[model samples]
Target: MVCLRCVMVVKEELNKLGYHYISVVLGEAEVIEDISAGQHEQLRTALLKSGLELMDDKKSILIQKIKNVIIELVHHSEDPLTVNFSEYLSQQLHYDYTYLANLFSEVQGTTIEKFLIAHKIERVKELLVYNELNLTEIAYRMHYSSVAHLSAQFKKVTGLTPSHFKQLKDKRRSMLDEM
Candidate 1:
């Protein structure tokens, strides 16, 4: 689960399955009662039908958590993180940064830094599409050191300059889940 709609779908599925959920947050849902195998399977299938997966393994769960953290920070948060990303991630997930990085790379076939860059570029695209913030504001909001840095990274990732992307007739932005 990476968005509010995904959380809604998960909650709806749990409710349909007659489970009392304690909470349903991004990438995780907690039910009050212990689920039997049959119940779990039913819930899993329901989630699949809604285009969501129920991760049972610890590693997969951890990966999802990492993704949720990134998605929440990039797409949802208004304030920038005061600490460096490595320290923040390690503090948030209760694991060493190296372990999290290795596990993420091993399972996802991509480094955490690359994943973060992809998402940041995607966010930049979104802001450009919205036309709400100027390039400098976007750079600051995204925690980039300067507009030149943001523009360079954006050009590298999208193969188009920010102004070019904005001026095009068909502006394209990727879905959050797709990223």
Candidate 2:
């Protein structure tokens, strides 16, 4: 689950199954009652049918947690991080950065840096479509060193300059899950 609507869907499905959830956050949930084996299978099947999966493997769960952290940072947080992203991730997930990076690359077939860049670029696209902030402000919000750097990355990823992209008739942005 990467967005509020996804959370809502998960909650709806859980309620339909008559489970009382204590909380449902991105990529995780806790129900008041212990889940039986059959209930667990039912929940897994229901989530899968709704385009969500109940991940059980440790590696897969860790990968999803990493993705969730990045998504929350890029899409939900307003303030930039005080520390480096690597350090923040290490502290948040309670694992060494190297281990996390290697596991992410091994499971997702992409480095964590590239994955973060992709999500950041998607957020940039969203801001451009909204037309609420200029490039410099976006750079600041996104923790880029400068506007030029942001523009170069935006062009490299999208094949168009920021200004050109903004002028596009159909501004395309990827869904968070797709990213």
Candidate 3:
């Protein structure tokens, strides 16, 4: 789950299955009772239908947690991270950076840095579409070293300059869930 609506869906599904959950966050749900294999399968099926998945394995859960953190950091955070990405992830997840990187690469088939960059680019797209801030402000807000760096990365990802993209009628911005 990446949004409040997704959390609501999870809650509704749990209630439909006659289960009480303590809470449902971005990537986790805390149920009041133990889940049987049957219930687990039902949940997996329900979430799959909603374009989400029930993570069973520890590694998968961890991977989802990592994704949730990145999503929150890129899309929702007001303050940029004080530390580097790897260090922040390490501190938050309580794992060494190397292990996290290797595990993420193995499971997601992409480096953590690449994943973060993708999310950052997506955020840039969102901010550009909103037109709330200029490129310099966006660079500062998103923690880009310079507007030129941000522009280069944005162009590399979207194949168009930010100014050109904003000028177009049919701007393409990806949904967070799609990413």
TM-score of each: 0.91, 0.90, 0.87
Query: Candidate 2 lDDT, tens digit per residue, 54-109?
Result: 98889998998999999999999889889999999999999999999999999899
**Most TM-score-accurate candidate:** 1
Ranking of models by TM-score = 1, 2, 3
Clashing pairs in 1: none
Flag the better candidate by TM-score, 1 or 3: 1
Give the Cα lDDT of each candidate: 0.90, 0.92, 0.88
Candidate 1 displacement at residue 4 in angstroms: 1.1
Instruction: Pick out the ten consecutive residues of candidate 1 with the lowest summed lDDT.
Output: 169-178
In candidate 1, clashing pairs total: 0
> How do the residues 21-80 of candidate 3 rate in per-residue lDDT, one tens digit apiece?
888999999999998898899989988888888877899989988999898888888797
Cα TM-score of candidate 2: 0.90
- In candidate 3, which residue ranges exceed 4 Å CA deviation? 169-179
- TM-score of the candidate numbered 1? 0.91
Q: How does residue 15 of candidate 1 score in lDDT? A: 84
Q: What ranges in model 2 sit over 4 Å off? A: 169-179
Tens-digit per-residue lDDT, 1-179, candidate 1: 98999999998888888889889999999899999999889988998999999898999999999999888888888787899999989999999999999999999999999999999999998898788999999998988889999999999988999999887724344444356
